[model samples]
Target chain A: MLGEVEVEVYAEVKPTESEVKVKRAVLNIIELDELEVIDVNGVKYIHGKARGLSYLSRIRDLIRRERIRDTARDLLNHSVVGDEVVINVNKQAAYVGVLSFAMGEVESPLGPITIRIKSSNPQQLIMWLTSG
Target chain B: MLGEVEVEVYAEVKPTESEVKVKRAVLNIIELDELEVIDVNGVKYIHGKARGLSYLSRIRDLIRRERIRDTARDLLNHSVVGDEVVINVNKQAAYVGVLSFAMGEVESPLGPITIRIKSSNPQQLIMWLTSG
Candidate 1:
C-alpha cells in the first residue's frame, strides 16, 4: 500500500529473547469503537482510547484564549497527535497472546518518538508485530 | 539573584527597527496569581498563566489510565512545562506599553523549540528587553 506504515514492536513485559527479529514491519492505525474485531494473517490487533491529541487541542484552545503560554509546542512542531489507532502488527512468525500493553519508538534525525499503546492483549500485539 | 534566568526577547509584531538590542537580558518567571503586579526599572514585564506542563501532566495521566498511546515521549524527553510565568524583560533604554501577546522560541540541538507567551503587554516586553 502507498501509505502503509511500519512499526517497531515491544511486548507488555520485557522479552528475555528476541521473539520476532526482522527489519521494519507493516503497521496500521484502526479505530475499534465497536467490540467486534477480526484477527487475520497472524496480525494481532490492540485497542485503546486516545487522549494525546485531545490534550494538545486543549492547549491550543488555551493559546487561543490566552489562558496560558504554549511551551511544549515550541519543542514539538510539525508533529501531530494521533487518535485511537489499531496496530496491525504484520510480522511473520509472530505469537498469539493477550496484549495488556504495547508501544513503539520511531527514530528521527532530530530525535526518537515513542508511541505507547494500552491494550487488553499486549502479548498478542507483541507476537503479531515480532513474528513477521 | 540565585535562581534568576536570562531570556532573549522579541517584539509583539515583527520589529523592523530593533527596539531593544542586546545579546542576553536578565529574565524572571513570576507567578501572577493575583491581578496586581508592580513594574520597576527599565525591565518591562509580561503576564500570563502557564499551560505547557499542565498539558504534559494530562498526557501522563492518560498513560497511567491507558487512555491513549504514548507517542511523543520518545522525542523531546526530559523536558518540563512551566506554570504561569511573568517575563520581566530587563534591558536598558526600554519602553512601556500594553502587550497584546508575547511568545518566544528556544533553539535546542535537537531542533528549534518555540515557547509562546500570551501577554497583554507584548510591546512593553520587547521594549524592556531591547533597551538595555
Candidate 2:
C-alpha cells in the first residue's frame, strides 16, 4: 500500500512542439490535481503534481493490459533510489495512451515523460505498481 | 525575375506532435495558397501548394536578414536537379520565425520542413533568391 506518496510529472515542450500536446501526453499516463506551464531560460516545460497513488491507475492498467508486468517490475526496481521511484516513459507512446518505458532520452525523440514518486515506502509502492 | 513556379511544402505530424504546430511551422516559412492534411497509412502529413515565386519571399528575406546568403546560395545550387529546387529547413527554427537550412532529418528532431520549387529556369530563381 502506498502511503503519503507525492507524484510529479514533467515533460518539455520542444520549440517545434505544441504545449497542449505535451500536456496531453502526460495526462494520458497520470491524473494530476495541479498542472502548470513553466518557463526556464526561454525553454518551456509542463509540470504537474498529484497526491496519492490513485493518480497512477492509468499506467498500472496499461502495464497489465500490455502484459509488461515483468518489464515494469524490473524498471521500477531499478528506478528506486532512496525514497523515490523515478521512471521515464515514451512521450509519443503516451500521447496515444500507451505506457512504454523508455531507458533514456534516445528512445523518445521529443524526450521522455519523467514521473517521480516520493513515498514513505518506495519498495512497497513499486511492488504494488508492477504487481498483477 | 522568377517566372511561373510551383511550390510544395510538407511536414510530418509525429504521433507526439500536434498537426496545427506542424502547419504553423510550414506557414512560418512559405505562404501556401492551398494546404491539406493527408494520411499515408496511419501517419499524417501537412502538405501545402502554391504558385509563383512570391511565396518564397519570407525565406529570401530571412536569408538576407540572417546573412546566410553564401550558405543559401551554395545549398540552393546543390539542391537544383533539372528544373526542380529542393531544400530542407529546420522546423524548430521556422516555428520561431527564423530561416535556418537543414541538411537532412538529423537537423530537426521532428523532421525538417521540406520546400520544393519547380520552375522553368531553376538557376534564375536561385540567383534571384540569394542575390541582394
Q: Model 2 misses residue B24 by how many Å?
A: 2.5
* lDDT by residue for model 2 (B16-68), tens: 67777778888888878767999989888899988887898988888888899
Cα DockQ of the candidate 1 complex? 0.02
Please give, for residues A60-108, the per-residue lDDT of candidate 2 as tens digits.
8888889999989888999987899999999989999999998865677
Off by over 4 Å in 2: B1-4
Interface RMSD of 2: 1.7
User: Candidate 2 DockQ score?
Assistant: 0.59
Q: Residue B26 of model 2: what lDDT?
A: 88
Residue pairs in steric clash, candidate 2?
none
Candidate topping TM-score:
2
Instruction: Report the lDDT tens digits of candidate 1 across residue range B16-86.
Output: 11112211111112222322122345322322234222222322332334422223232212222242123
